[model samples]
Target: MAVKKPTLFAAPLANNGSKWSIGTETNVMKGLSQFHDPLINWSVESYSIDSLGESIALVVRNPSEDMAVTPRVDIYLVSADNSVKPKLLTGSFNAISDSPVFIKDGKKSVAREWDCSPESIVWSANGQTIFAVATDQGNNIIFAINATTGNCTRMTDAGSAMGLGTLGENQLLFQYTEQNKCVDIHILDIETKEMRRLTDVNSDKLRNVYIGQAEYFWFKGALGDQVHGWIIKPLQFNTEKKYPLALVVHGGPQASIQNIFTSTMWNSNIFANTGFVTVQINFHGSTGYGKNFTDSIKHQWGRYPYEDLMIELDHVLDNCSYVDKARMGWSRWVRVTAALVCHAGIFSTPGAWYGTNELWLPEHDFGGTPYDPKARSNHEEFNPERFANEFATPTLFIHGGSDYRVGVEQSLAPFTLLRRKNIPTKFVYFPDEDHHISSDVDQIKWLTEVLLWISEHTNTTLPYNLNQ
Candidate 1:
């Protein structure tokens, strides 16, 4: 007998396949609203189907009833035979906090978070057990969630597991990335709970090159909250030599720095190779720790998270003998802290700054909703414009004109003000791009501008034509 493929049911705007045969503007807008993740990869909220075609599971994100700016993801199951309507599977209280399906270089990055989720749901050969990725207390792991009951069982202990899929009858195949290491494939046996490494791609290429060393540390943060973080030492670092510290802050006020392969945009390997000891602080309001930790910076925003960063910085500079306190510099992409750094004068020796799609407008800050009265007040404090009179750091602002999430004006306004104040500032705008620079050409341009600016300010010379 031939197997029937599962039919998909989603609002017209769902990133992938939708149940609807047609589309409309209103449906698109409704679907767009469900993209709750800061790095919104337009994809289906969730997809799952039983082997016997008895049920289809869907994870949909809808506007939260309590919070106007937040969207909550919930799972629902419907009878495949069409004999029954959809019934909610998971409760509203527990959110499937996996980072969405991450596709990098045409290969799936096996990590899941809200909205953009798992590449595919893993089902046992008998379809009795369903496995999915979830973020539990600041760690990403695979969990055995009941297919029908919507219950969950933790499966893997490896802090991070990506691209999880079924192997053989009782095993799983996934791409694994550990702290300060390269990405590799691994296999897990469900019955005996045994895990075996599959491949080591890093060893072949890195035989002669030194890779950074990484370790985890915790500290007391905002409101005496326990904050977890990671510190990555420069390649071939010496204990007696002090190196410039690079403070890299992650976006998502809701996301945390994971102990996965450090390749992506904030390339830790490149930074380590460039002779900089990198530090990533989960700070306040970072995910994978706990709901309270992630939510700690909800309204606190700039103040608490910055404090957490400062405390971490202080600890590193004090305890770590290799961290050069006089040469400390910081960098962040997308949303968190660019404005805060400018307005608050946080970093002692701020270096060449690279920020894209900066959020500086009161109307657009903090979800752009009237739900929170403090959003405007918070924006007013950290607003890049507020620091124009005293903007001292040499800054490079880049933005995409088509960015709907954060308007180009956010970068343009500050760049103009800084230029007027006679501060060293540069603005690079791409009219065709959105919030993210998707095209390779645009990305290279952005990186080139960043490297040239940093090199100019740091008094280093890179063998690139700066005229480009």
Candidate 2:
């Protein structure tokens, strides 16, 4: 079968004088023009022409090729004069050349994922170098390419570039994050590639409150590969006193939790401010590290990654003596497949609150990939229904009725099973919401219920707002 694809083509400009055409003429065009070879498997994402208009740069994504969850993005360079064919830029991989320049700020303050994209190719004043944003080791940074020598030099590393623009002859203006701080303006010298901060937007306001301190933790996984995670110490934490621990599991099973200011259904800062030590583990399948790490959990959903999380938990508990082992609680965004598996194994844990349960419905959880009988059987093995009789830990299941991604029925099934088996379970479904409860009213109610459930089960109470 011939695969149809969108191909880029260019045409020459033509001018007609007043005497050249006296009547209206309609010409029939039938033939097609092709720029690159038809055998290429990639599609153009975005394109830009250099300042001199000598070469054109194409941000292309290889649909046939993928790394972990997303496709492999590369830049293809072609001559605007049609002198040279399109060639993939050397040393480019896992890049988001077509990503939009958005300010990744939180509601309360600016965010840390301050990434910026220059107009594909921002030719230097001398037109000798091209500056752009590229992803490196999960973080996006500014990069400069020597157009003539083909040498690539990194420009900025303080934080991801949120916005980019040329300043003067040798300086570039951009908004970026610094360390664990919020977004701010900075100047980058093109010649020296040195960056200097120009603004501190929220420093004074943030100084009044205690912000959670995040520290990176690394340990060897089951396969001897290094695993990474972060432990956020509660505000005004004291090393002498034991603190309650809350473990957060991210969804997508394939997605990752990077070192950015993130505030979603599972907010680390909220947990920290509420007097609980928080931990986020990027298991074997999380993105950003590399293709190998993301693909490690392909078919082994609840196996390897679960072990990694357990190992990570053990390491944190052993290293952080201030974490009260008896007061540990579990929480996660959306589907809680990994948490469900581990929660079943850990009977001594106080309680677990999973925002969504995707275990019973494997088709929805795995994006309808259970075609063969064996695959369906494997799904049954990971199904929480199998252990309904043995489920003892009190678990709360909250879901959105309109969540078509992972239907509310997924949670309903397990919730029913647990209740029938007298496993102490609660189900809170929101009919007006979708995969996520967006409205502030629903969000407050959801968080309040979650905190109340945890407190009631763990013998610890959070400062709940009665007005909410």
User: TM-score for every candidate vs. truth?
Assistant: 0.69, 0.65
Across residues 1-468, which tens digit of lDDT does each residue of candidate 2 receive?
Answer: 445565455443435854343332211111112323355444566666554545566666665554333435766666654556556663445445563221212112121232322334365666666677654443556777665565676787534675677897889988776325667888988878778889998889778656665777789876888888788898678999887777877766667665555335455677677777888878887776666777777556667777887888789889999987777776532132212212112111111112223332233334343444655655554554555566556667777776654655556666776688776777777788887778888887777666666655555546445345
Off by over 4 Å in 2: 1-138, 143-159, 164-169, 178-180, 191-193, 332-368, 463-468
* C-alpha RMSD values across all candidates: 10.4, 10.4
Quote the lDDT for 5 in model 1.
Answer: 27
**Tens-digit lDDT track of model 1 for 7-96:** 254223334564535343221112233343444333346555554545555565543332222344666565544456556655654444
Candidate lDDT values, in order: 0.59, 0.60
Q: If candidate 2 were superposed on the true structure by all CA atoms, what would the RMSD be?
A: 10.4
lDDT of 2: 0.60
Model 2 CA lDDT for position 187: 94
lDDT of 1 at 48: 59
Pick by lDDT: which candidate is best?
2
